[model samples]
Target: MTDPLLTETREDEKTAAWWRQAAVYQIYPRSFADANGDGLGDIPGIVSRVDYLAQLGIDAVWLSPFYPSALADGGYDVADYRDVDPRLGTLEDFDAMVAALHERGIRVVVDIVPNHTSDLHEWFQEALAAGRGSDARERYIFRDGEGPDGAEPPTDWGAAFGGPAWERVEDGQWYLHSFATEQPDLNWDHPEVRADFLKTLRFWSDRGVDGFRIDVAHMLTKDLTEPLPSRAELELLDRSSGRHPLADRDEVHEIYAEWRKVFNEYDPPRTAVAEAWVETPERRAKYASAEGLGQAFNFDLLVADFDADQFLRIIADNLEQARATGSSTTWVLSNHDVTRHATRYGLAPLAGRPVKQGVEWVAAGGPEDELDRARGARRANAATLLLLGLPGSTYLYQGEELGLHEVAAISAEQRQDPSFFRGASFDGLGRDGCRVPLPWTASGSSFGFGADGAHLPQPAWFAEHAVDVEAADPSSTLSLYRDALRLRHLLQAEEALVWTDTGRADVLRFARPNGWEIVTNFGEEPFDLAADAANVVLSSLALDGQLLPGEATAWIAPA
Candidate 1:
């Protein structure tokens, strides 16, 4: 039997190291909740919902970009970094929201978009008026156009959103955007840019922000050499140690190291994570180092298939990364930027490969018409247990706990993602389906999201997953999440995890050193628990007598 004193010590240690193994919930501001009936979620709404989050058993809340923005890229294009957007709330409202969350013992992580600023930002506006080569222009990445008359873009790089990364100016020069035309990439080499971001970091930290998630962390510090490499050459650069002309430049760490110093100024030293999309483990480790942001997202599981081999491979690689960085790795399945895993799991693999589920499928009545949602939700529910049972942090996008799926379809005219309208390149891509407003009740113009309507439409089927509807049902996904989380606190006490061989195809079984046995059946048949599996602590789905259903997970008490 475990001693009370030992258990207490473990609890104390867990408190001090919460960020390492936190269950962070991501809130996409516009869709989470709404107050003032403005058709958009506001800070007051979040303040009102703090109790809900606290009850959900999350360690922290990751609020997506809510700073002053033009909504060009769903609030990622920041016009102001230090204050809340007027549409979302006033700074005073933000303070109350933070206060409410902290009162519930929940930490707050705000998004920090340092790579670029909205074109409407004061500095960017001044750059346009200051003319080329001026100090204001130097604050951004402006280059002389290529060719004789200076009419062509400076580089052949494509913007992540769609078209050319460089946009020509009225002054016969070109400025690098790397995103929407309304957003201009800032020059990290500029002292002013570096100094201003430090100020922004402290500004939020002073306002009780517990952490920052650096947006596009790998794309800062461009190699401003003449004759920029083509996109093909940029791909080749990833294989070499040489700095690419565009992204993942080595000098970017200098910026993070400086930010780390600022992060250390707080009482507990505010924490941070990088949204770096780097591929190699060694490269990702640099961003996740303690001297830098302390953590970088391990996104392998985000796009991995449901197959056991793929999941095990991703988990192994991420755990290895955690060992190398001396920080717990992060796991995530769905977010505002990607298709909800609920919908993704519904579709069959395309020719034995991971299927790409996009706006096209979501628009065509979703998988409801051509796929089995039961299989999808069953697998997703099991994955949740698999994730929480692991040894690191698990981030959950809002609404997944209720087993919410993507909206059936979004009309083209109502679609608002920048990718939707940017170009045909993104024609099949747009994140609106995943960003649709959440359903809080079974009935309402916006399903209790607000008094009137939601910014993004929620489908009628959303009523089936509404909080009020599911909260009353014992077998509902909401109850499963609530129970699983309550048990996770007890089960996660033992950090070390060992993979157990089940000697079966498409099955995964792992055990915490001192906790329950986690068994997941991805195979086609039900799995019978061994005789030692005497007590069942939690099941992701209903068990068929002594057999764990296919596409299900069971946590049997330690034998």
Candidate 2:
């Protein structure tokens, strides 16, 4: 019904489109793959896994930061945004990796940490050495007068990792660092600072990158005049690095809008995924509007306690809040920065009891025990499916499809995270458990990541539940993930996902235009099919209608 030229244009648009109904896989590169025997993940290593990711049916792969760095903050505190970190690979290697992934129709989006830079970063060093009242000093937030006099910091805020937020730079001056001392905050108000950031963004965009995931986006601006944290906490925090205020000033949006303008200049258009963990709906909407960021990571699901009512409310609330902001929302389960959801939700261990399945799976001795394990797996599976079928975008962490759980035993010596180093105990050694290397093969020393064991060890469980082992077994969680992902993409709905008024908070029901009703039971008991329901389309459980542990089901027209 259309001319060939017009059809070709639409095809081209589809290929370049960055923000559509899609699923994204986040790869913490250092922990994703290691090609050479150097014990570190590299560009070639990531290239080798493109096919594996492609099979997962994701439209794009969002790689964590890979720029040149001092390995501080795991590459977030970049030294050179234009060059590749030697530990990862050369710039040429990165170009080749990009080419390889694009050849298979998968877009690439990398993280950009503009809020701060490594104190060792040339720019930061220049600013610091330039001393007070120098132009270079304006690039950072350096204060004058008698600094933190062994008392309280300049603000009553705790560092995200732990302790106080401000650190003394010299005898009479201090600098603001919300994270660590080695990482110094950039002054967003500085013209040169903004110019350098734009240059870095454009450099990557010009290289055919699909988009960027802005790191700690809300922390770009701070109130230097705020009061400091408790004296005791300040002393402890300073032992690591002084802290700074959190998410200060809405003026950050104005700065982001300017960057958005540059991003829009791309012929195919580009996206800026903001990392703002907005606590309120009104505040969240501002980052995803037409004049703001293209999309923002919605941590609403992350903070949920994994109850049926809470899950439903979070989804419904986000949908309402993001509707006016161009209806582009991102749903994420696990990331390099958070504990895996399955472990967090207690699905792996219910009521202080461990339910064993997958990798370390134990076949129950009795049918009753088997049913209980199946039921648990069904609930976990249902929640994941529910997320994929939701409106807007879905983000799947590297190992989530394998239903990976938290490592029960990680010694203090193995803990290398900035958070752990800063005395942050409960907030999880700063995502190190989830950031462990992916396990692709069960037999190999590196679990199929590389010839040698990766620099950071994969959890010990990988020996039991690697992808290669699961791929050979038809009943593995890896297989279920592939099935779910394929089904999600095969869905031929023109309209986006829409929720149904199922009334029961424990039961999440939604309908696609293709006559499919996806229902998930998050409760501890069975949910009978509603009178109007026809038949089961997809079940995360066994064929006996007994919802297995961590399983889910989708229903449609009866035969």
Candidate 3:
């Protein structure tokens, strides 16, 4: 395909607003690459890999949290938002990394965690020391107990990581923490708390960062005066429905609107992508409104199964919602939090049913256990093509290009996620499976991830999917990503997506305005594409003559 979209030299349109229709790569700093041989990936290590990212044809990089943290929630418990973690690198190193990325025409989007702060943070520490009813305590959500002697908690709210959301201080006051106890929720009702975050936003933006990925974007405001919902009601508050006391409230949008004002003050205007897990598409659209953050993650497709009907419905819903709000839709597959799609697609139950709820772990032995690694990989590749071919922006998680599978066998002693430790039933099975360090080379210590062993142990089978190993083979997953991403930039820039009825119920066929067609076969049987397809641009797997195999995707021009 020729560069049809680049024919117009609209220099005035070309500015820092490059996020629209961009392919952004998410980098989990601890697991990306280790330059200093310290077994942990750092900013300098990421700096070393800039050329690799440029070669992959990504427009931007969204880095996960790397602030000064206790690592209680894997850097989500941020102690200091202004500086880089000593383990990761210094602030100087962060500046160098950003400069290198910008030089390569890649934008940098850092993770901004405004919902909570580490208990070890100076403000949180002062709140604890200043005792109850003090000004310091006002920075966080601190409330007195309801019962006699203040023995009972304020309410029956539950934490996302597993226990009671309220933890009592030595002064007999309970503070709310929606996640881990080490991370106390910030009191957005306080003007000082809001000002501090505004300063934090400016601090990074002043350092030349292009944008931010707001963590827990829907979780800043809470009606602390209202009685907490019952445990049953809380359980009803999944990703899709039900209104909670603390999440997706109308007040949260006000905060983002203020942030948006600050974002616009910059040249070309810094953009923010919200990590809001709101219920309905309408509610999600509110977070991405003109006054709000401008982009919110549309996770409907991520929660869907590999079925054609479910995929089409989610895509249509997302695009419609984005259009309603005048914002671009954001598509994502795997991230640091969820189970990798490579493993999720292999589980037998997901083959027939839609994955509405988040997946934690798949049982090892069951009568209907149908965990096929090869099949899962094939589906993952197909799904990537489908995601990229869509009409808006896409986010790619680290190590996905190598087609890495979930390392579900990590032992109990090596496990680090707070979710695993908090829930009895979730023991030995947490997010550590997907957070394993990347394998750069096929051999050497930690698969060349570092000089020493990785922070999270790499599985023995990781060698098979190492970057050096895959780069040499043309048919490897890494090559597929390179080819797909390069072609995606050329073909998807100015195209409009129109769904096509392939007549087969199990097939999803969509056509683009640029004479490109995409067909994905989710059915058990092979799909004959000889009649509909002219020249094959790409295929997730080797096609049997002119037949697209089951669990595969093909890109072609119309016959």
Question: Best by lDDT, which number?
Answer: 3
Candidate 1 structure quality by residue, lDDT tens digits, 1-559: 1111111114554554678878999999988999889999888888878988988889899999998998998999999998899999999998998899998889999999998999999999999999988999999999998789988887788887788889888888899998888889999888999999999999999999999999999888887786677778776775335276666778889889999999988877888999988758888888888899988998887667678988988887777778766777898988877767877677665334333445446521343466668877888898888898788889999999999876747877788888777763322548788888889999989999999998887888999999999989989888888887777877766455777778786888877767577898887798888573468878887777788888888887775
TM of each candidate vs. truth: 0.94, 0.85, 0.93
Ranked by lDDT, the better of candidates 2 and 3 is 3
> Between prediction 1 and prediction 3, which has the larger TM-score?
1
- Error of model 3, residue 323, in angstroms: 1.5
Can you give the lDDT of residue 132 in candidate 3? 79
lDDT of 3 by residue, 389-425 (tens): 8777899999999999887666768878998788722
- RMSD list, candidates in order: 3.5, 7.2, 4.0
TM-score (C-alpha, index-matched) for candidate 2: 0.85
Specify the highest-TM-score model's number: 1
Q: Which stretches of candidate 2 lie over 4 Å from their true place?
A: 1-18, 145-157, 170-172, 225-248, 347-378, 425-428, 492-498, 501-505, 530-537, 545-551, 555-559
What tens digits encode model 2's per-residue C-alpha lDDT throughout 395-487?
A: 888887777765534556765678767766434345566777878887778888888777665666676668888777766777777877777
Ranking by TM-score: 1, 3, 2
What value of lDDT does candidate 2 attain over all alpha carbons? Answer: 0.69
Ranking by lDDT: 3, 1, 2
Clashing pairs in 3: none
